[model samples]
Target: MNRETLVEIKNLSVDFSTAKGALHVLRDVSLSIPRNRVVGLVGESGSGKSTLALALLGLLPDNTGEVSGRIELDGENLLDVPPEELRRLRGGRIAMIFQDPMTSLNPVFSIGTQLVDAQRNRHPQLGRRELLKRADEMLKRVGISNPEARLAAYPHQLSGGMRQRVMIAMALLCEPDILIADEPTTALDVTIEAQIVRLLDDLRADFSGSIVLVSHSLGLISELCDEVAVMYAGKVVESAPTKILFGNPRHPYTLALLACEIDPEDEPGEALVTIKGGLPDLIDVPKGCIFAARCPSRFGKCVEEPPLCEVEAGHKSACWLA
Candidate 1:
């Protein structure tokens, strides 16, 4: 079957009116995620990854400044949709597994209540017993043992990994068309993190939809995503098929990121490479390249912001070199 474009984000820009001034979070960022594929958004903290996810779901803060751009899901413009429509679409057409599952879950509510309530938004006709059964099955699918007993427990009662798994189960119970996992494994250990990633991969067979995995771990992205968009500051500096991008990173920012990845062959006590300089202040962003201050290959033209242009077929980079 031919996969079609499921989500298209075009020229998206976001700014917030803080007490000090306007803080630009996203700048003309555009991306396309094909149906049934996993697209990874890899970037450092405060790179606008989570901001983009909220924008896609029409959940941006109302106090924010003008947000310009079109977020189209299955050819429908999400930005122009009504609030009620968007709310209805959120857990049904779209769902998010947040960075901190503990915070995402309500401490007052039992896990069963939260899971059942989530599904009830779409399946209000479901009986109490049926809802419990569905929640139990989903919990099992996410690798949680004693699903029935766990459902009766509160958020604090479970281990960090268990809570994260419950969050995953809740998000997937609705079977959304788009799943935005923003640092889903941030709180898990190495073993649990691997298990969570594997669970997500396995659940894809049951969910015929696209996923946007927002993470700072390039290794995780490389392993789970079909395509990757490398974000810097607030812009996408490089985007391409995962293999192609890793094999031939054309952008300076992307190359620097790749250089920081751990290598198994590296000798003991070798210091890992680090990207020079800090992220630019959003309130006083430069007119030039976002990475120009730290770019080793900086040139005269880099003093001007470069458009994200195609460097090769199906590969694009936002650099003067591209």
Candidate 2:
């Protein structure tokens, strides 16, 4: 099948002016999201996964961060659009389910009110009765029972899982072209996390759009993503189809991440292997390969940075070894 390209990011970079200096959060990053596919951004903390996701949505703080790059949606570059056009695009063609639903949701407003407000931008003509009906249906679709009662409850009244579901429903109510879920299952229990993941998996068929799932959990990415991009030190070190990435990872950073995945069958005394050394300083990122400091396979050639090179069909890795 010839899948459509829903979003394209080219030479994207973001830097923040900190007390110390300019802290680079993203560097020359580029990727694409195909229509109706779930792509995951996987990396440890400080890897700029969430930063890239926010950049896609134009959510970065204007004054604090300097962003340069083309965020192309459909055929037009979003950076070139006016603020009003970007605002219209946000809640209409694109929507985001923030990591913390509690913070994202207005504590004073009832769930129904929030849901109605979510659609207000796109459906101003919708009557209250019609909006309420749509909200109830979306709630039920996300596996929330007693949808009518839940709508009357405030954000504080709902459990973490329920709040997350409500947030998902809100993001999807308008049927956006792109859904950016930043750590959708964070802070939930194991059972609830599994449930949320399954719900998102089921949503693919119902919502005809692409999904960018930003997470650090390789297990969740492997289970839910059709493609994965591995980020490190503000750069994408590797990207490929999910199965290929797991079976034949190219970048040393990608392999290190796999090494850290916990196995249920491990002996009681077995210690989880951790990636040696901490993340590089973003304010002063290495001039050469960022992972060279921790990479066991690093060679003298790694002293110079490597551009993303295609190692095989549909698989690319940024490493001298590749």
Candidate 3:
């Protein structure tokens, strides 16, 4: 692992055994996120975006799933850590904000109780009064209008946007070194989503920690991420600085994703370009490129899986043509 890297995933693979067979969810996925940087993981639904996030946090469901790889955090291999140590590291050194805030939050407990619990978990020595004070302050920082009033409310009492803000506050209270937001804004309205994005930007600026943003929106990735990784069926197809990936995408899958989004200046009647063919079933993955069936530029070489090769400085693409 690089000394300067905050989180490094090397040759990571994850699988789940079902009644049918073994489902390969992540295939040789590797990524490096440096300190104080934002790396966006973008792909369509069922592209293993959320799986990768959960794997990093060691939060996969037990009994059916298996994970293997080197997941190093701040030079320590988290994959090899003991269960007790991993538990301690989860909320103290790294935290995760799940996609559905309502589901992540407790419907029965008061928001204050949840936030205070999180605070106490991190700083157990802090008194109850101190924990409450800190929780209120964090709530305010996350843009809640009346921190005291909202703290008394249950998760169901608050709106979706407000619940998400509370979730962010809870995550921030831990002062984690790396924050993983898995589709954090997927359930909010446009106005609230923009506010959440801005709040994340402000938090990142002040916290000085690495962030892993997993989302399906290309526009959001372009606006908020410094670096981008494009995922296909179960592997990263391309990765580069935000500008480079958006300006000159080398993988057909990446190009298809970008094309699916409508351009502001496009003609009124212009039809969106949709990628033909659906993602391959994980239980029976094809031998060649996962995207070769839908790739417009695929050739005979595409029948054999292509390695992720460097296409340019700091840019890599997994495509035979690239």
Candidate 4:
């Protein structure tokens, strides 16, 4: 691992044992998030984006799911750490902002109580009043006006955007070294989403910490991420810097994704390109390339699983064509 790397996921895999059999949710997913850099994991729904995030935090469901390989944070392997140590590292060293803020926050308790409890979890010595003050400050930092009034309100009392801001505030209260945001702006409007993105960028600049943004929108990733990883069928097909990946996408899957977008430069009568066929089921993944069924450039070699190969400097793709 590099000395400057904040998080290193090496050959990570997650499996879930169901009544039918073992289902692979992630396979040999390796990634590195350097300190203070923004890494975006972009994929369609059910591509194991959220699963990978949950696995990194050691928060996967008990008994049903199994996580293997290494997850190193600050040169320490998180997978090998004991449950007690992992628990302490979760909120103190690493934090998560889930997609749905309403469900993530308790409906029964006031926002202030939830934030105070979260703060106390990381700093046990902090008194209730001090925690409350910190929570209010965090709320304002996240762009929530009238934080004191908002603190007294329950989760149900706030709008979706407000609740999301509250969630961000709660996640930042501990000033974690790494922040895992799983579609943090999914519930907000475009304007609010932009605000949230800007807020996260500003926070990253201020805190000098790494961020792992899990989203399906390539546009958002292009805007906020320094690096991008494209996942299809539970495995990454392409990994490259944001500019290079968007400028000249090499993998067929990546090309298809870009073609699907409606560019302003396209002629009025031009037909939009869409990748045909649905994503493969995780319960029974294909032995060969999972995207081969949907890929337009598939050949005989595509029937065999292709390992991720370097196509260009700092660019890797898992396709025979690449």
lDDT of 2 by residue, 1-322 (tens): 7867889989898998888999999999989899999999998888898888877777777544677888899879987888888788888989998878998999999999999989987798998889989999999999999999999999999999999999999999977899999998876877898899999988887788899999878888999999999999899999999999999999998888887776744421122236878888998888899889999999889999999989998899999998
Q: lDDT (CA) for every model shown?
A: 0.88, 0.88, 0.86, 0.84
Clashes of 4: 0
The TM-score ranking, best first, is 2, 1, 3, 4
Query: Per-residue lDDT tens digits of candidate 4, residues 99-210?
Result: 8997789999999999998877689998999999999999988899998999999999998888988988888897788888998887787778888888887887687678
Residue 54, model 2, lDDT: 76
Regarding TM-score, does 1 or 4 come out ahead?
Answer: 1
Task: Give the winner by TM-score.
Answer: 2
- In model 2, where do residues sit more than 4 Å from their true spots? 265-273
Cα miss at 76, model 4 (Å)?
2.3
Task: Decide which is better by TM-score, 1 or 3.
Answer: 1
User: Local error of candidate 2 at 90, Å?
Assistant: 1.3
TM-score attained by model 2 = 0.95
Q: How many backbone clashes does candidate 2 have?
A: 0
Error of 4 at 214 (Å): 0.8
TM-score, prediction 4: 0.91
